[model samples]
Target chain A: MARATGCLAVSLGTALQICLLFGTASLLSVGGGNSVVPEIQLRAVDTYHWLSAAQFGDLFAIAQAAPGPSMLLVTLVGYKAGGVVGALLATVAMILPAGVIVHVVARFWQSSSGARWHVAMERGLAPVAIGLVAASGAIIARTTEHSPAQLALTAAATLVLCATKLNPLFLVAAAGIAGWLGLV
Target chain B: MSRDRPSSDVSLGRLAATFCQIALASFGGGLSAWSRKVVVEDRGWMTDEEFLSAMTLCRVLPGANQVNLAIYVGSKLRGPRGAVAAVLGLIAVPVLIVLVLGYLYFRNGSVPATQSILRGITAVAVAMTFAMAYKTGAKALRSLPAWVLCAASFLLSAVFRVPLPVMLAIVAPVALWWAWPARPDASP
Candidate 1:
């Protein structure tokens, strides 16, 4: 019983920590969830020891597979730590701050126009967002690339995606097959 | 800008419902297409040109593209309150579903069927992301300089493994220099 209580407390604490980290990250994630991968990997694998490196990769896969934002990995990690309550807590924590900020910003943005700083900031942020997106693609490729077949698939997919009008879902399906077949 | 323009005939409730439908239907991450289908094709809420303009604005704004989309659609249909209602409705169901699923998933790490489905979904998602990147890049890369910047950014990050923020610091100033409005007499 004491052990159970101790575990519960630990889980709750972990959930809270996850929320704070993710909340801050969410606000800063102007480029999207992929941009936060480096930080997430560092915390989840290096700092927390909640999961091994391979497990983090699996969680990332699960997050991408699921709908909504990729930042949903926070809920997955919280769930692993504590369960439903933890998941709920973590999700709220991660989403609420950014939601509120966006809401407020949208409201204000509607009325205000021709603000110099606002224009400057938007102009300044665009290239940063572009760079971050590229970095994120690279990071995902680095982690997911494991073998000759996987590398080939990744290159082919990237090239096809950049060059052709073919639907991306086909490539993903091919990659999954490769993964299942131990080709990657 | 007409601040006193009357609201569209679409009721707030209907607007909210439309947003919810979009959220639920966005199983894969092709939200831009899904949004286009719903807002422009199905509902006739906005014209294609209007939808595209709003999408551009949303992309430049901070926040999830979908959330920004809800805001734009809602604001167009009604006003500020409509925007709030639409965004809330869009997120409410997804959050609830994710919370419940998170509970089950945490309690039990992975079930075989679920794992298989997720694996399939992951592949689809990767494809969807690539498609989005390609589409967006085509629109954004209008000039040779812009294309060069894109290539430089990609190569720097992918090959050199430079941190994202650092790369941003390097590329942003260059983009600014290129995008900065020219003086009247400075034109060639």
Candidate 2:
């Protein structure tokens, strides 16, 4: 009985921690979902020891492989640590604060019509967002596999993606086939 | 390709269902395009201009851009309750699906075949990011100052390994100042 109670206590505590951790992540996520990945790593892997860096990477891959938003990886993280309850807590905590901010800001923007700063802010941030997104891409490439074939493939992809209108998912599937066959 | 923009009385249920469809459809990136097709063209919830501007804002703000966008669109349509409904619809299903995938991965993570497949996919995923960079970066890579800013921002985070928020703090003010709307009567 005591051990079961202890287990419950620990899980509840960890679930709460997941909430706070993700809440902080949402607030600090300046660039986008991908931007806060390292922070998520720091918390889930480093601080909490819920999963190793490799496991975190695997979860990311799975999230990518599975259909849906990339941010759903947080659900994986939560489930790994504390099961379904943890996943629910993490997802809610991760989005609610940010959602409220968007809501409140939208309200503010609606009320403050004709605000000149709005357009200026949008114009200025557009370029910054663009650069940061590229930076994010670079970071992902660097952090993921960096074998020679992968590097060559990435280079090829860069040229092709910039030039062509082909869908990326098809390329991803092709790459998977090559990988499965030990080509890449 | 669907040409049916929803009528103006976007109920909370309709908002939820629409975002839910977007969430399910967007896989392996292209969330933005999917959102555009649905929100701007399909529902006419927002004009193209409104959609573009909101997208830029979503990217600029914190959290997931898509999720933030859902919030923005919902709030624009029907305030806080709408925002909640939209986000729930967008994520609830995806979360369950991802967790199931995670479970399978955890169970079979040691398999050689699984590892190999992941290996290939990871490489391609990296490439997609590069492609994403190029696609988005082209827009801002037009002018000299924009190029300089892009390079500086890119180098700071990608090359120099600076944290994103820190780089944002350093770059945002200068970039904004440079992009400040020019006076109408200013000399050409």
Candidate 3:
């Protein structure tokens, strides 16, 4: 009886913690979800000790393989920590605050398209945004890269994507086949 | 710039399903490209310029840029209900798949075969990201100020290890000042 009650208490606490942590991440994702990856890692792996660093890495791989938003990682984290309820809480918490912010900004942006400041903002910030996108790619590359073979694959893929009209999903499939065959 | 705007006749369910189809198709990254293809080209929801600007705004706002984009398009089409349908449709399947993957991983433990498949997929995934960055960066690099900002941002955030927010704070002010709206008398 005591153990049952203790289990319930622990699960509830874990659920709440997931909500708070993910809620913070929701607001802090300034340059999209990737921007807050490190923070999310720290809290889930280091602070909470809910999962090991290795587990986090595996989860990341799984999230990448699955479809939808890359931010599905939060759902995985919440599931590991607290079960189904925790997963729901974490997913909702991760997206809701930012969703609200986005809706408000969208409304403002729709109305202010021709405003001078809006024009300036649209023009000025574009490069900065592009640069950030570039930086994110580089960061992801540095982390995943292992061998010269992998680097070559990346370069070839980039060229193919930029130079051809080939569908990207086919390229991804080819790469996956290579991996499955132990080629790449 | 005015072409046919999105028809007001687009039902809420269709809006949800369209976004869902996009989600299904976006196997890799580059949701923006697929978004443009579907919303701008196929559906004639908005002009390309409108989509690009909305995409830029979405990138800055918190949350997943694509998710925000769905909301932006949804709201533009059908008010608050539009947002609900779009977001729900976008995330529902992905969330389910992710949870299932999570379950399987822990249940079976790490298998060498699964890792192999994931690594391959991930390698291509990373490459897709590289292509996207290059494609977009090429466009931004057309202007000198934009190019300079791009190079500086890449160096600081990727190479020097400065955090994203800090890097943005350092570079954004300068970039924005350079690109600020021109005053009539100040024009050279």
Candidate 4:
């Protein structure tokens, strides 16, 4: 009976630890989910010893490929630490604080709509935002593209998407087939 | 081109389903593009200008850009409950999928051989992002100062790899100054 109680306590403690680690990471991830990847890796792999480095790498691949936000990486990490419950806790911790901040800001933005400063903000920020979007593309290209063929695919897709109103899903599907066939 | 604006009275279920579709459709990457398509183009929930600015605000703030976006759009449309619904829709299915993948990886001791397919998809994903940039830029980059600010932001972010906060610190002030609305009484 005592052992059982001790085990329960340890699991609860582990869950709490998951919350704390991910909660802090949630606030620190200013540049999006990828910003905190290294921090997560260092803590989870090096400090906590929850999983091997290889496992972390694989999870990252899985997260990127599985769809949705890659920040779901936290879910996997939490799963490793505490199973289903840990995963839920980690996810909530990761999103709640940051989500709250964005929500408040969104409300404020809405309330200030059509004001002169708001107009200034909308215009001034639009250019910078578009720039960041393009920068993300450049960064992703540098990291993901290896061969000239892949580069050509990206370039061609960009041109097609820009000039035409073609749905991008078709291009993405074709690229996948090319990859599966080892064409690119 | 700003057009008819959709009402924010979107039902919670619709918000959830819409975000769910957006999340699932972003297979390789470019979740942001998928978001813009659904939120601005298909649904008409927001104009290009509103969406662009909201996106930057989300990026500048903490957390995952997609999740933050989900929160922003959801809250705008339906308040706190809407935000919850959107986030759940966006992540619930994907989280389960990722968990399954994690299980398989841990069990089988290796990722399944989807590397090549992912490679191709990743390339397209990059393209999707570039396309998003081009599409939005055509509308936003109308002025020389706007072009300069966009270029500076792009260079700082892509080439110098300046951190976002620092880049924003350097560029935002100039952008705000240039874009500040002229006093109605004083300026032409």
* Top TM-score model: 4
Q: Per-residue CA lDDT of candidate 4, range A143-165, in tens?
A: 88999999999999999988988
Per-residue lDDT tens digits for candidate 4, residues B62-102, read 99999999999999988999999999999999988887787
Give the i-RMS of model 3 in Å: 3.5
DockQ scores for all predicted structures: 0.22, 0.50, 0.52, 0.65
DockQ score for model 2: 0.50
Model 3 CA lDDT for position A68: 81
RMSD of each: 6.9, 5.0, 4.4, 3.4
lDDT of 2 by residue, A1-184 (tens): 0112112233667878899999998888776788789889998998888888998998887776565578888888877777767777778888888778778877786565345555555556556666666776667667666588877877786677668877566776787788788877
Question: Which residue segments of model 4 deviate by more than 4 Å?
Answer: A1-10, B1-5, B183-188
lDDT of 3 by residue, A135-167 (tens): 766777687767677678878988998777677
1 or 2, greater by TM-score = 2
Q: What lDDT is obtained when candidate 3 is compared to the true structure?
A: 0.75
Candidate closer to the true structure by lDDT (higher is better), 1 or 4: 4
Task: Sort all candidates by DockQ, best to worst.
Answer: 4, 3, 2, 1
DockQ of 3: 0.52
Question: Can you give the lDDT of residue A17 in candidate 3?
Answer: 87
List where candidate 2 sits over 4 angstroms from the true fold.
Answer: A1-25, A28-65, A69-73, A80-82, A107-114, B1-62, B105-113, B119-141, B183-188
Indicate which candidate wins on DockQ: 4
Candidate 3: pairs in clash: none
